[model samples]
Target chain A: MTTVARADGSAPELLDRLAADRATGALSTRAGIFYLSAGHVVHVESPHSPDLGELLTRSGAVPPAGWWEAVERAGTRHRVGRHLVDSGRLTAGALELCQLGALFDAAYCALAHGGTVLRFRPGVTHWLGAVRPVPVATVLHESWRRRELLHRIWPDPAVDTAPLTRTGGTGPVALPPRRARTLALVDGVRTAAQIASASAHRTFHTLVELRRLAADGLVAPAPPPPAHPATGAGGAAWDEPDTALLRRLLDALEAL
Target chain B: MPGIDESLLETMRLPGARGALVADWISGLALGAVGEAPGGDAEATAAETAEFARLAVESGTLAPATPAVPATPGTGSPPPPPGSEPPVQDLILTTADAYHLLRFVSTPFDSTVFLYLWLDRTDGNLALARIRLAETADRLVLG
Candidate 1:
């Protein structure tokens, strides 16, 4: 048998290994956190993407009061999803759809993070519980596909990570209403994820819209963040290398 | 409300259904699937079908026209209410050997999920499959 060089090496490799062993636990990556149950990815959370509750309340799936109540009553037992459904706040299918959406949305960013520090804590399931267990393969494969799609739509990754501003040109830009609305939210301070949360929209969808905006010159990076964010002027305070923050300078242009 | 697996099973009960799947149109991930996929790979099929659905749903030329702001009673149907059902409810594709039906499900969120059913052409009743798929979509549970 050939040596398994890649097993548990990268996020994808580790997930594959876990699936093979039917392992259950949480995989903590710099990009995001994934909770697996018996080899199935029950939930995934990314710092750059809205969580299930955000998606649920923002989408008007369940009222905010009801959502908090469910969490208070059932979150500790990992039955928040079930609680919401049983309480008739929403149907089981609706919760599943929303949960899947949130999972895939965050999973894409989580994997896109692609950092080296990947850790898995065995037997630690998410308090949200396994609303619907997605196969690990499906999660990884979709993340790759989304990365490719975003690249193809607009090869620039800056629009995804950088703060954005609208183009000053007065030319009428004919765009679908959805993209137009997302564009209006750009104020040279909010990154795609910030805009997504502020608008209560899916972070991935917001990214797609931003990419499209960049492709059409409707949006542009506000300004390049410092490339080498080292050595503070006041004192030597080493800050955490926030992936999203560091990435803001990846495509930064030379200061004019 | 039938959960995803139960919903798939319900669709499979159709007379000519060869397979069934629930996929997110936006992410192209197969949420739940049962039986053989047209591509022999459920994930692959889900992605391809999602592409097909996006083309139909997002195309400006094919979507229903937005009604003018001012009230005009004697005119075509008003555009679907924002955040309501998608303009196009379902789509059907006929192949040489089988029939494919995609029914969009409305949810509290983006409503990006759809039900895909593959039915044998010879034995499948297109009308029946369409109705059942729509019903299944209405009640298919997720969590």
Candidate 2:
């Protein structure tokens, strides 16, 4: 593993440099990877973010079978997005929206995982092809703005990772369809990530809604998870000294 | 139907068009934008526009009443009336120098996106713009 050290600079800087160089292909960080084409960001995939296929399938735009077929048939064609559009499974517009939403969603999490071991493999394209290439500047700017919006509503970062439950006092306030859909999935046992997986809304948007709901006093953080003694030492993956140092560096960078 | 990029370009073709953006009001994120922003900051403008959208759609005073669904006797809350139109079609804000139109776009899927058009008040025709914007919104196909 090509461990990217704190001396390599921040994730934003790395992306900026790649864009400046007009680099093409995948930049793999330990947390996830960002795929670029001709310097523009084409796709981003992170474990913390729900997959684009799942988001699209759940959106009722294309059925699961159609999505699976697209993935399977992408093979050497590398035109998964085009296949879907040509097959009338979805419109070019809808595909663009889904790709854009997923890009921003995954990019945010990728940037958050700043200190991971970073490796860039040139000419590595995603199977989805390029739905639409978003400018790197816009992607970074929007992610930063989204982070601010979340903080404005609920400053506690803990609210983001914890399971949520209704506060139970405010009379039913009418929620928008997506928010209502998301709220229905918040069963008090699922974290924000889990809730996003269950709902059709994009993961980032779901988290934003959760923060908004938190601000409205409609939801509160569930108590911490019980201590699992059996899981000890097995969780050593995140305890690397470099990882801790990188996280601290990221925190300092974000604070700036 | 025009995808977001083409739609945005079409919007800017309107007379006196200052700028245009396709924004998801729920999350205050811009799907796409062209030309300049009113405040010179697209992100800030999106957030401000979202506040308007959230208010217009959420407020009972502003939300249009749905075609009434017969209330069931035993259900705690009645089933929502079928086929309710979106709360607001478009919101037009006439400032001293510009005409700001927030046209909500509907989709077969959940519709939370809207077109924000900023036109110079002196030269832009509001009536024509309104009609064209609605047509654009109708023709828009969101994936």
Candidate 3:
């Protein structure tokens, strides 16, 4: 990664330089605030921070789909924490806790990486931090540990960003501890909705089971639905057979 | 008459009580604490314990298996997910000589703090100590 230092001592200026240069590296300030770039801040920990989307999901205050929609809508216009609170999704106390948590996590990551201040800019600053090479083995081990703790396997990153879906696949999966007899019914052929319809278990339990299965490398990511031909708003597009069929399926699912 | 000090004193009364301290998990700062001083080193232990709590919560390994109740809107985002809450709020470490219990108390002020206790394992009833600690935490008020 290319590193550049700016004489302008301001956070905004540093940020501008980075954006102008299209540079990717850890940025920090003397104040101990720093940002890591991983598809947009894989981690951020500051004394002052917002509730991360991950924190919101874990809190169970917002559904994953709902949170994603909010994020997309908010983009960078609104402070995420403020947006969530304004939307009546969280309380002030909860917001404070979440912000603290995010900041703490980000700080830990920054410290672990041995971050250095590169330059200060007005509103934007860049700092270089030591990059700790994370081994894939470490990730896998942590994943396994998480699996054991949550008692559910969640191998898909999409679950964190997009709506959950089921994809069909054929594979022999080995579950840790002991495999439940109920898991025998999962063949990747059934949608989560379908499984829910057929089973008497709670939705949370079924979802957890699906996540575990996905984590065990037994299930594949679901394919995106085919695009529909452009049609007038409210214009019946039954003219295109595929569009009509997909529409019908979506409608059916919505009804269910 | 002060709540936190009284709580600390009560913790000391427990069988084999070594020391007791209160800490803020957010900033890793100790508010008030008493006991063994661990060779006159309560601050270090309090800071260390706070770090432990923070790490445990962030690691998601020892997080509570159930989700915390969502705070009312305007308070910010909801609590962390199920299995994201730490369980060592009142940690009881069993050693050959003493039992250490750290109990966390979430005040209405939104400060995530806890009381750390050390008791002699030989004389402590792990369960009873936990109950008393919980009660003590409830009565505590931050200065």
Candidate 4:
């Protein structure tokens, strides 16, 4: 709790300044690291969003061995994405979509806490390179819009951190295929973040589906925490959220 | 193979093509865009079109039978592989003076995105645009 947003400038402000300066480097926040090129957000890695490898290989897009090969060949130069495309193992369109999806998915959580910019290293770049560079204004605006959209669907954020399970009270609950795939993984043990990785679904899309499920009374949301100090502005708490999430978040955040 | 920028440029070359965007339905993001946006705001248009596209794909009546699940078991009609043709290939919305086409882009992984092309009805060929848009979706590279 005490570790969040100690600086007067939060995520948006810090990013705005960097964007204004047309800075190219990595900006570290409490939630994740955002790689910027000439003030544009090129890549992002966060605990809330599954990494590119998981999004690709875990979804059966590329075999584990093939992915490993790409990393071996291109990891050092931060061109794993380009290498995958060039090697014909993956399409440029597919890689781009995945990276951009991963970018916004994680960036939403990264900016959610309004965490202070922990540290910024000039000229530091992601190993994935610049797959799709988006302006800082667009990135920031999209993050805020996503938060608003999710809130409109379901105001409470508890469902986000809660483990989900079918109500099981009703038989034959018809659902869209995507939501069905997501719901099928809700075993009351795996939370939304786990479901995102396991299902190869975008983090925000997973949240949208879960919020809808909660709206439909299909899954029980975690009861609102009692004014936890670790919660974000909208009562979003990644801490003690299934324990595993917190640990991974810590490892990912600390490793930076 | 055309990357996003190049693909959009190709779309712009189409007759009556006012603008086009590589929009992600799931995230409602414009991966790339070229030319004009109907509302004069590309991002807002991307979000709205994405919302419309998602509803179409999610609604059982609109979406084709699940591609992953074959209708008949052991009938030799195996379901399409993942990342194959999307359940909804393309959606055409006819407006008062324009045609909005959303062509879903299939990927190796679960795909939830499309190419949105806005064309002037008088200048654009719906049939040709449909064919070309689909071709663009097929060849539109990302990396």
| Cα lDDT tens digits for candidate 4, A35-101 | 9999999999888888888888888888989999989989899998889888987766678777888
lDDT of 1 by residue, B1-143 (tens): 67888899999999989999998776677888999998799989998999898777666666533523444343223334543545456788988999999988877666478999999999999988888787788776433
Residues A1-256 of candidate 1 have per-residue lDDT tens digits of 2222222467888888888989888788889988889899999999999998998788777789999999999989999988988888877777787888889998888888674435678878777877888888878878888999888887777677777888658877666656777888999788899999987878888988898887776776765445665456622221322342344345444422
Question: Which residues of candidate 4, in runs, are more than 4 Å off?
Answer: A1-8, A222-256, B67-85, B141-143
Error of model 2, residue A67, in angstroms: 2.0
Best by DockQ: 4
Q: Candidate 1: misplaced stretches above 4 Å?
A: A1-9, A224-256, B65-85, B141-143
Per-candidate TM-scores read: 0.82, 0.81, 0.33, 0.84
Pairs in steric clash, model 2: A94-B143
- lDDT rank, highest first? 4, 1, 2, 3
For TM-score, candidate 1 versus 4, the one ahead is 4
Per-residue alpha-carbon lDDT of model 3 for B86-126, expressed as tens digits?
33345666767777677766532224577888877777777
Model 3, A44-148: lDDT tens digits are: 433222235544564455667767765666645534545555676655434443343344333433332333455422333122121122222222233233334
What does the lDDT read for residue A225 in candidate 4?
47
Lowest lDDT 10-residue stretch of candidate 2 chain A: A236-245
Rank by DockQ, descending? 4, 1, 2, 3
Clash counts for all predictions: 4, 1, 41, 3
lDDT of 2 at B94: 91
lDDT of 2 by residue, A29-126 (tens): 76678888988999999887777788777766678999989988883677898888888887777777667777888888777656353677778888
Candidate 3: C-alpha RMSD after superposition: 15.6
